[model samples]
Target: MFKGFLTLRPSCEVCGLDYSFADPADGPAFFVICFACIPSVALAVWLEVAFEAPYWVHAFTTLPFMLLTCIPPLRPLKGWLVASQYFYKAEEGKLVRLETPRNDDLHPHSA
Candidate 1:
């Protein structure tokens, strides 16, 4: 399903499913930044505040941890999101006309 690490193929090879609808965009990145990166940031902050850690400590510890948390899960998360979009048939909303009774239909006896 993937053409590259973060890119998708144009369509599915086996099922011939078009990938045009799989526009996950920054959803995977946003999730990684919001959910995954927080703990790494917290750890860095705590180290700085509590232990007064040096830059090299962060380089060895926090940097690797952040990369591990943030980068690796992106492809899986994006695939899951795209699969969900396909399964749920997610699409843009459209304005639809509702059928309501006109005056003639509501007051047929009055006529």
Candidate 2:
């Protein structure tokens, strides 16, 4: 359900399914940050602590590694989440209030 690297198509080409409900906003990015960026950051920290690597080292190694690990999987992750939502028919929760009987309603006196 994607048209570009991170852009979604309006509808599915084969099934013609509307993608309006597929709002995986920040989910993919959050996963990437948690799974990929954290490790890359740890690598950077290790490099700094062990070898005292300079900024250029991070710019060359850590940055590219982080980008490669973080960027590539976002689209597929988003698609998987969207498909899961569709399969499960997930939607926003609605607040439903039930009426409770008052004490006066419980006791009705015949006049």
Candidate 3:
């Protein structure tokens, strides 16, 4: 069984503005950011067929092209890629929260 998790911030904490849910049906912008790898994966498969390359070679070669394609479009997709990882875990335990403060909040003198 595959279970997916999405941590959605559906409102502005400061302004209390309501945002849409992150679910695919909600038509939120989250999926645009989160699914950048889908194109890359598809391209890899297409390249494999188009080039008639071995699976490993196609996989490696397409990676650089994918990176190139992804970089230009990253402004819209970056948030989604970052947030999508929260849905998967390496082990069978609940996700652990790290208490690290944001870089902006850390004082230069404290470091």
Q: What is the lDDT of residue 4 in candidate 2?
A: 79
Q: List the candidate 1 regions with Cα displacement exceeding 4 Å.
A: 95-111
TM-score of 2: 0.86
> What does candidate 2's lDDT look like per residue over 1-111, in tens digits?
899788889999999999887888889999999999999999999999999999999999999999999999899999998998899888877999999998778887832
What is candidate 1's lDDT per residue for 1-111, written digit by digit as tens? 998899999999999999998889999999999998999999999999999999999999999999999999999999999999999998877999999999999989998
List all candidate RMSDs to the true structure.
2.8, 2.8, 15.8
- Largest TM-score belongs to which candidate? 2
Candidate 3, position 38, lDDT: 72
Candidate 3 structure quality by residue, lDDT tens digits, 1-111: 101233445665777544342233332344443555577777777777788778688657777866666555544343344334334422334878989998868876676
Candidate 2 pairs with clashing backbones: none
Instruction: Return the number of clashes found in candidate 1.
Output: 0
CA error at residue 14 for candidate 2, angstroms = 0.6
TM-score of each: 0.83, 0.86, 0.30
lDDT of the candidates, in the order given? 0.95, 0.91, 0.53
What's the C-alpha lDDT at position 31 in model 2?
Answer: 93
As for TM-score, the candidate ahead, 2 or 3, is 2
lDDT of 2: 0.91
